[model samples]
Target chain A: MFRLLIEKELREIIGSTKFAVSFGVCSILILLAFYLGAANYLASVAQYNAARAENLRQLEGLTDWLAVRDYRIFLPPRPLTTLVSGIANDVGRTIEINGRGDLVAHDSRYGDEPIYAIFRFLDLDFVFQIVLSLFAIVFAYDSINGEKERGTLRLTFANAVPKAHYILAKLIGSYAALAVPLLIPLALGSLLLVVMGIPLSSNEWMRLGVIIATGIAYVGVFLTLSILLSSLTQRSSTSFLMLLVIWVMSVIIVPRGAVLLAGRAVSVPTIEENNAKKGKLNAQLWREDREAMTKFQPSSSSDPQRMASEFQKLMQEMADKRDARMKQLSDRLNEERTNAQQVQRGLAFGIARVSPAATFALATTALAGTSLDLEYLFRDAALAYQQAYAGFMFKKTGVNLSRGMIIMRTESGDPEKPKSINANELPVFTYSERGVSEVMQAVLPDIGLLLLYNVLFFAGAFVAFLRYDLR
Target chain B: MESGQPVFEAIGLTKKYEDETLALDHVSFSVRAGEIFAMLGGNGAGKTTTINLFLNFIEPTEGEARINGIASHKDPLTAKRNVAFVSENVMLYPNFTALQNLDYFSRLGGKTQYSKENYHAVLRRVGLQEEAHTKRLRGFSKGMRQKCGIAIAILKDAPAILLDEPTSGLDPQAGFEFIELLRSLRDDGKSILMSTHDIFRAKEVADVVGIMNRGKLIMQKHAAELAGHDLEELYMKYIAGHIRDAA
Candidate 1:
């Protein structure tokens, strides 16, 4: 009996022209997003290789390892980032690994290419949040009420069918009709990535699988919500209007409003204030160091080698002191700001998670390793790489670069015959992605919330339909 | 089951809408097996309300609408299994073929063993053209749709059928064919409860004709008793509130 009812539902939706048009539009958009994502990743790969080559070319004649300054490391592109984007485009991609002071990342994709940010990437998350959700609403907003309007409700209920079985069939059959077909485009897009020769690791495949699963769950949220609203209203038009208002509030208004509210509610120190304070402290330290340097007298001036060693030692001590003081101040300020921002971000996302769309976006982005956490993850990886770099430079120059020293070796040799530095000897930065288990653990809350929503709305629809006036 | 027992009954059935308007005021009637009970009234005369109660689409304010000795409200699913219903509009899923609609409603009525041939035979039995059976119902005419509804009831083979103005929009010739079909169904021992405003058709087809005023059954007569009487005049007199004066 349930099978027959579900079959009827499938036949009803599949035969409608609405399904044809919506499925077509969704397919085209999904394929386009995948194609563009591959193209964007390829472009980034080219740019990364070019930047590395340029950094190496600039060091072709420098024999001294300490002479090479501004050796930059770029954040490598991940294929999944192109699909779920998150804050990947918003955050900086280039971090200059210096032997001295605190570092900052620069060269954001959106800064370089403002047009893409204006419309944003047509990623899977956006499609699921905006397009697929609309399709769900369009298909299901009148699911129950439309039957009433057409006068089929009374005719159907006249049978021996239990309202529970009928409502469950409606949800299952509609979901199968709407969501199963969507997988076709998702599969095609995934194949397009392979066809474009974008290598996906086994881990990446798992992440992609979860992303698609979450997309389906997200679409389910809207489908059940529509059914709930449909049973609540007498007219399809009224249900649709109410659903449209809900969609707007959940998808567009709530997440951003929470962020704005959090921003006003929580106080974090501005970057400019931190920078200005650091600048003043730096000037004071430099003035003191300069005064001390003026009184520097090599006690062993009669011995040329001793005099050179003594002078290097004194300079290193002063530089180390200044570095320590800067570190102390910067660490304090950063810790303060980080604590405040953490509170602000926690409040914002907590509120935003009230909406399923926000939950989906946040979870998928985290799974894709491209949420706002992308910025900190990249910085942490670069900072770890700097440790190996500092060790390598110390071996090459018999002096730790972390001393923030300027070593001047005046060599009287032919400029054309100067030996080149080995760029390969520089420590390579390899970023480690969050383990699948770790990511799954992190987003379990959101996924659970999504399922809870489905159950709640399904129950709501079921209860509402049981009492619904078939007439 | 006793041979003389009523297959469908309304015992003191009453319904009041949320607006406090009484839609069915302790209306009582019964259709034994093989009886054609035609209920006649003007608009909002508790005719369709009676059928709705029997189908359990809405709850009755008082008493019971029983099918095959089971109270519809007490256990609607089990009770409805013993009955079939065709609403006024005969609206099925538009995307479904006539045959598909028959197959669905037949299955819903718990007749799962009906085959394609059985559905086609039933459709043909209701005078639907063989060519129209497999075509979608979206483009079907009102009469064609009505034939499909009757076909569904025929396939259900239930002991009782509740039709709410089943022939409301059917043409004269279609109405005549539907009446003949109803007569044949009655001969097959199916109790039929039909609500309509057509007085002459009620007089012609029904074994027992009931006239309702507002929410009360004001008059009832067996076809044998009503023979040679002008049913249209009687219906008009009752609708005009003259029955009380005459009484």
Candidate 2:
């Protein structure tokens, strides 16, 4: 009997024109997302390689390590990032490793191409978050009430069917009818990923698989909610309107509203304020250092080279002291701001996760390595690389490279020209993505929330239908 | 299923709505095997309410509506297993064919053993054309949809059938064919309870006739007892408060 009810529901849905149109639209959007993601990834790789090569080219003729300025390291693009695209494009991609002060990433994709920011790329996350959710509503908003309106509800209940079996069958059948067919497009999209030569490692493939699963779970939330509303209302139109409003609230309004609310609730110090404080301290330190430099006297009976070496040593010591004080103040301010931002992020995401759509986005972005953590991860990696680069510079030139040291040379005194340093000899900076286990740990809570939404809405629908008036 | 065995029984069934409308009040009637009982009444006369109680679509405030000796409200699944229902407007799945609708409903009715040939035979029995059997029901006319609904009931093969104003929207020829179909089902020993406002059709086909007014079953008699007496006039007398509690 349960099987028969499900079969009827599947036939009813598949045989309708609404299913055909929704399936077609979903397929096109899915394929388009995959294609565009692949193309976008290829473009980013090319640009990244060019930028790295250009940075190296600029250092080709440098005769000393101290003169090598404007050296930059770039954040490598991941294949999944192009598809999910959470904060991947929003955060800066290039970091100039100066071995001094703080490492600041610059040249973000969105900043470079503001037009893309205005209208973002068509990624899989967008399709699943917005389009598939709407399609879920379109498929199931009339699941129960429409049958009543068509007079089939009375005819169905006139039999020996249990309400539990009937409602369960409706949910399972509608989900199967709508979600199963979607796999065709998804499989084809994955095939497109392969055909386009986007190199996804095994861990990335697993993440992508989880992302698709989460997307389906998210779609289930809307589908079950639609059925719940249908069972609660008498008219199909009323159910549809109610579902539409909910979709708007969950998908459009809730996440943004939560962020705005969090913004108003929590106060994080802005970057400009931190920078200004650092600047004020730097100015006072520089004035005192200049006075100290002016008061320096040369050693008696000194060789010209020894006098120059003595002055260079004093300058390096003062600069080192100044750099240390600035570092201490900067670290303090950054820590305070980071803590506040963490609090604000926790609050925003906690409230936003009330909606399944936000939960889905959070989970997929975490899996794709494109969440807000991407910025922190990049900066941390760059800071670690800065340490290595500074050590290398110290070895090449017997001075602290991060102390703002100035090198002076008299051209006429040299009998032989100095050899240009090899730019390739510099230590390479590599950024590694978070391991699969770590990402899954971060993503599990959101995935659990999505599943909870599905179960709760399905339960609501089941309970509502059990008490529904067939007449 | 012996002859004269009560397949459908309503013993002192009472229904008082939350609004206190008194939809059915102590309505008691029985439909025996191989019998056709017609409840003749106007709108809001508690004719449909009794059928609803028999189907357990609504619970009776007091008393029982029994199908094959099973109280419908107490054990609806078991009671409903022995009964088939045809609504006044037999709306079916518009996206399904006439045969498809029949197949689905029959399966739901626990008659999964029927084959395609059985479905075709039942559709033909209900007077649906062979060509329309495979066509989607969306474009079906009122008569065609009615034929499909009756086919579903026939395919269920339950001993008892309930019809709520089944012939209210049928044309003259369709109504006559429906009457013929009801008689054939009766000959097959299926107890049928139909509610309608059609006095002449009730006179022609019903073995027993009942008239209800304002939640009360005012008049009931065998067709033989109603012979040579105007059923319309009798119905009018019961509805106008002239005849009181002649059940």
Candidate 3:
């Protein structure tokens, strides 16, 4: 009986013109997402490679290693990030690594292209969360109440059919109908990626699969929501209007409202204020260090080499002391800011997760390694790279390279002749994505939330339908 | 079964909606095997409510609507299995073909063994055209849809059938054909309880006639007892409470 009902539902939906139209729109959007993502990823890779080549080219004819510049490493584009998007474009991609200083990333895609920010790319996440959710509502909002309004509900119930089985069959049938057609577009999009040579790793493909599964779960939430609303109402129009209002709140208003509310509620120190404080302390320390250096003249130092050696030792000691103080201040301020930001983010996302759409967005982003954590992960990778860089610079120049601290050679052997340093010998800065297992862990809670939503809505609809006034 | 063994019964059945509007009031009736009982009433006369109770679509406040002596509310699924229902308007799934609707409803009624040929024959028996068998119900007229509903009921082959205003939109020819069909069904020993406003048809075909007004069954008579009487006059008197003192 259940199978027959499912078969009927699939036929009914597939035969309807609305389903065909909506399905076509969904296919186009999904395909567009895949196409745009692949194109954007290709463009980003080219831009990233060009930037790296340019950085290396700037260090071409350096006479000494100490004079070598252009050591900026960029965040590499991930294939899945193109499809999911998340915060990949919003976060900065370029970080300049100077041996010792606070690193500030710049050149964010969104910052560079304000036009894209106005209406973000139509990624898979957007399509599933917004467009497909609406389609789910359209498919389900009138399922029960419309039957009642048409006088079919009473006729159906007049038989030996159990209400539970009927409702279950409806849910499963509609989900299968929607999901099975949707898979066609998704498969085509994936094939498109392969044809375009985006080169997704095994781990990336796994994440994409999970993301698609999550999108289905998110869609199930909306389908259940619509059914629940339909069962609770007497008329299809009333059910549809009520569901539309709820959809607007859950998909559009809740996440943004929660963030705004959390922002107003939680007080996180701004980046500018923290930077200003650090700058003020830095200048004060530098002035004191400069005075100490000027006061310490070598006593009875007639030898030029000896005097230079002493000056070098004195500069080294001062730099060490300044570096230590700066480290202490940076660590404390960064810890404080990080703590505040964590609290603020926790509050914001916690409230936003009340909506399954938000849950899906956050989950897909985490799985794709492009949530707010993307910025931190990029910076952390750059910092690790900076550690390696400092060691490399220390070995070559015998002096640590702070942002403003410079060392010049006053004993150039030949002023007219230029020598090129071995820039190719520099350590490669590689940023690896989070492993699939780690991503699964990060997204597990959201997957549970989505499942919970599906279950609760189904159960709610079941209960409401049991008590429904079929007459 | 014995002569008095009722296949369908409403024993002291009463219903009051949430708004405290009494839709049915202590109505007691029974239809034996092969009996054709027609209930006559005006609008909001609790005729549909009574059918709803018998189908277990709504619970009665006071008493039992029974099928085969089993209370409908006590074991609804089992009780409903022995009965088939055809609503007045016969609204079916618009997206489905006439044959599709019949197949779905028959399956719901526990008649999964019905084949396509069986569906076509039954639809023809109900006077629906072979050409319209595969046509979607969205384009079907009121009479056609009603015939489809009767086709579904026939396909169910249950012991009893409930019809609410079953002749409301039928043309005179179709209405007469429906009466003839009901007689054929009765000959096959299917108990039928129908609600209708057509007093003339009720007098013409019904074995027993019931007159209800404001949730109460004011008068009931066998066709033999109503042989020399005017059904319209009695119905008007019952609806207007002119016969209230006698009840």
Highest DockQ against the true fold, candidate: 2
Q: Which candidate is the best by TM-score?
A: 2
lDDT of 2 by residue, B1-247 (tens): 5666699899999999999889998989899999999998888889989999999999999999999999999999999999999999998999999888988999899888989999899888888899999999999999999999999998888999999999988999999999999999999999999999999999999999999887888888999999999888888876776344434
Error of 1 at A169 (Å): 1.8
Residues B4-117 of candidate 3 have per-residue lDDT tens digits of 699889999999988999999999999998999999988988899999999988899999999988899999999998998999989988889999999988987888898999
Report the candidate with higher DockQ, 2 versus 3.
2
Clashing pairs in 2: none
**Fnat of each candidate:** 0.77, 0.93, 0.79
lDDT preference between candidates 1 and 2, better one:
2
In candidate 1 chain A, where is summed lDDT lowest over 10 consecutive residues?
A: A409-418
Stretches off by above 4 angstroms in model 3 are A286-320, A403-405, A412-419, B1-4, B17-20, B242-247
Per-residue lDDT tens digits of candidate 2, residues A225-337? 99999999999999999988988999889999999999999999999999999999999999999999999888953588888878888888887899899999999999999
lDDT of 1 at A219: 91
Candidate 2 or 1, higher TM-score: 2
Please give the CA lDDT of all the candidate structures: 0.90, 0.92, 0.90
Tens-digit lDDT string for candidate 1 (A1-471) = 899888888889988989999999999999998999999899989998898899889888888787888888889999999988999999888888875556788899999999988899888888899999999999999999999988788878888888889999999999999988999999999999999999899999999999999889999999999999999999999999999999999999999999999999999999899999999999999999889888889887789999878877887888789889898999999999999999999999999999999999999999999988888888888888788888888998876777766756676766675477888888888888789999999999999899899999999999999898887
lDDT for each residue of candidate 3 in A228-323, tens digit (9 for 90 to 100): 999999988998999889889998999999999988998888889888988998899999988998798885578888888898888878877887
Which residue pairs come into collision in candidate 3?
A: none
Superposed Cα deviation of residue A132, candidate 1 (Å): 1.3
On a 0 to 1 DockQ scale, where is model 1?
0.70
Order of quality (lDDT): 2, 3, 1
